[model samples]
Target chain A: MTADALPPRTVRSAPDRLLAVLAAFDHAHPALCLTDISRRAGLTLTTTHRLVGALTEWGALERDADGLYHVGLRLWEIAALAPRGLALRQVALPYLEDLYEATHENVQLAVRDGGEVVYVEWLSGRSAVGVHIRVGARWPLHATGVGLALLAHSGQPFQEAYCAGPLTAFTPYTIADPARLRRELAEVRRSGVAVSSRQITEDTLSVAAPVHGRDGGVTAAVSIVVPHATAQAAVLVPAVRLAARGISRALGWRPEAR
Target chain B: MTADALPPRTVRSAPDRLLAVLAAFDHAHPALCLTDISRRAGLTLTTTHRLVGALTEWGALERDADGLYHVGLRLWEIAALAPRGLALRQVALPYLEDLYEATHENVQLAVRDGGEVVYVEWLSGRSAVGVHIRVGARWPLHATGVGLALLAHSGQPFQEAYCAGPLTAFTPYTIADPARLRRELAEVRRSGVAVSSRQITEDTLSVAAPVHGRDGGVTAAVSIVVPHATAQAAVLVPAVRLAARGISRALGWRPEAR
Candidate 1:
């Protein structure tokens, strides 16, 4: 197909088309050429060139020496102002670090978004586990500790919708039954803890607890992952709860007697 | 003021209009309504409404309860992959925390951008002096300890260009004079440290050193801020230097020394 041969076309709005260009880049595809972006965003070359120029001029995208584009520093600066992203991470980091120091295990802070737990902060430790969760990664509510903790406290309607998922199991031991997942969430609410064993990975176990915001609403969840074979779920449960409560208090969550 | 009475708008390209809408938000005005966005982006209400709706649908923007819009979690998730943003901070944080513990002072990480130093991370210690610096805050190159450290190592052309700046002075102690600032940067290059005293604020002092990347280029700077009245700059210098070096080593910078 020749570039000048095609008739002008339009369907999606201009803003949607421009944003689609940005959405094309991900962790694996962090950098892209002009052609790569056009193909990935499913836009014509002319459209992509115009959109890329605008984004580059506004500092939304940066083009490097190899003619590849990256997420620019200006975007990062603005994103730093996001209340639920960097702001929350900043407030929760010290407590997360303390947990890491105490356990020398993989520490994570995550928030639920549309039935999935999006990891915001990950502190890699010397202790190696096979879970392999990274910042910006997501997992379904029934397959991870933070996921279960967040899902358990997400109110009745949200829980009901999430439990209807045809869950993908990473290992044979993952909780796949809708009825059993319902019972497990109830247990999480009553016990104030979620212990996920061999769900995401065969050799890793995670303990998580809910964190609350100033308005006494469950805002986030914190967890620690350890080797499943030698894990002491009982011993780690108290420490995980203590860390979550400390973070919740810092966020101005005042708990009454349960 | 009816919509039909308005004249047909002058046509900007599709990408320009869309990008202008996103560029409307900044640190000073993080949230806005539809009218505000239209006014700020210089677009018609029709165009603004369409673009805002598209962006909201794509998750680049989020509307709050009262209809004010904010930078959304999705954009922040993408920005988290910026190499100079969260990615760099993630690697430097543990060492910065150790420095904060040892000094009990305000610890910071910054990188040079367009003749200014933009802070990427800030750890406000409990006992630190009250110097108001927020993450993503930018300041003149000669006015901050981290700035001087970065400026000193930023190659000869950049250093010379920055030295010709019309420096903004926050306090009487600020190094606003071009000649004196050049001399200070030179000394920073020689001593491998930068001491900024009572510059940004009369009650605060900062000690800093440069961090190098794997390729031996100055990539970031780390610093500690203390009370100026009772400060020991000499004592803090070594600690700051050690922290910077530790972070550099972690980033795979190998300083060849016998």
Candidate 2:
């Protein structure tokens, strides 16, 4: 949905209005001017100016020489402390690197946020399949390997609710039927790996495995994406699972716990 | 300073109070209960609870299963748009990885924030020097090689204000004297590299070079730390400078632009 469709801010609270300004920035609109922020946030020009001034003063946003506003370094510092974000990526990077070296493919670490999988980290290989993925990018839980891995391990209630959904499809192979999605998730849990082929795109296949946190719950997923034409699921599955287990161990997960 | 040292929140604005709650989380304290957050933010329990609730609903703060609050994934997604944060690191990572493969040392990418250098990326080598560096960690601008490189190129006014300061010394080898620091900065600017030995610790030395942005300004620095006893400046300097230049070019910096 476009930002212009957001509801007006007259009835929102002070904190809500303030957050609306920040929420106006997203992957598609990373930089904005005051009027753009006002229209996107559904705030008046005066309110946007005041809130933007406050945010700039507090280092939550920065204005460039060209007068365009971007997210600031201070906000990044705070966000770096998110356990599911940079902190998790920092712990999982070495293993991800090893996985990349082993397969020379695109490696990703992602966590489930609501019904979608947010990619927290991605390491690109020079000759890997051309996938449209970046750090902080999100995709539906039924369409990608990492997403399937996470959704399968997400608890029964959430899984049931997710299956009863308007499953969006990016390609012809995407699982649009809830019954098929449910079966795929069950297979993922049974095999301890998820292989998604040509779901998001026609030329790529991904192998993913769930990563456990200290509490022994699946907190994240690790995956490797390669060209589907020459894909070797047998080799890629084991490598991806090993990387996930290595990351889980690093996160204080013990095999005996489960 | 401890959280108790912050002044009361009565005089602050609404945005300031909300931001204080976010600012309460840092490297040392990434998670907190409501009471801890209230104390750190210097707000009353009621105000803190209200603000925290609003933030949690907005997905800027998340409450864990154990009831501790953490900076959330949604916040990280927004913060990823910071030009000097993950955006810069994204463009620089391949070059940084090449440098790590070449040196097999502690590689770092840092940007100057005020008078300190904030490390945005770090790649650790298994047997490399055990330096106290982490992503999002900060160090003064006069005691490390990356800091020196950034400080040298920060223009004369900022350099003068930074040098005429109470330089905190971590080791005896640190440049605490203003005149010596000026000379060191001049050398960094002249040679296009900065070499710092035993400044942060007794066993580690670093070589760094400045990275320029599309606007032709030095916006960041890249460095590699190694064991001081076996350090080879002639070899490391060229490698570090090449990595920095490569990252600069990726950021749209051209040699002919200047």
Number of the predicted model whose lDDT against the real structure is largest: 2
Judge candidate 1 at residue B154 and give its lDDT: 88
| CA deviation > 4 Å runs, candidate 2 | A1-7, B1-3
Error of 1 at A103 (Å): 3.7
lDDT of 1 by residue, B38-76 (tens): 878878999889889888888778897778998787888
DockQ of each: 0.50, 0.78
Note the residue pairs that clash in candidate 2.
none
Stretches of candidate 1 off by over 4 Å are: A1-10, A125-131, A256-258, B1-11, B125-129
Instruction: Report how far off residue A212 is in candidate 1 (Å).
Output: 1.8
CAPRI classification of candidate 1 = medium
Q: After the best TM-score superposition of candidate 2, give how far the Cα of residue A50 lies from its true spot, in angstroms.
A: 0.7
TM-score of chain B of each: 0.92, 0.96
| Model 1 residue A73 CA deviation in Å | 0.3
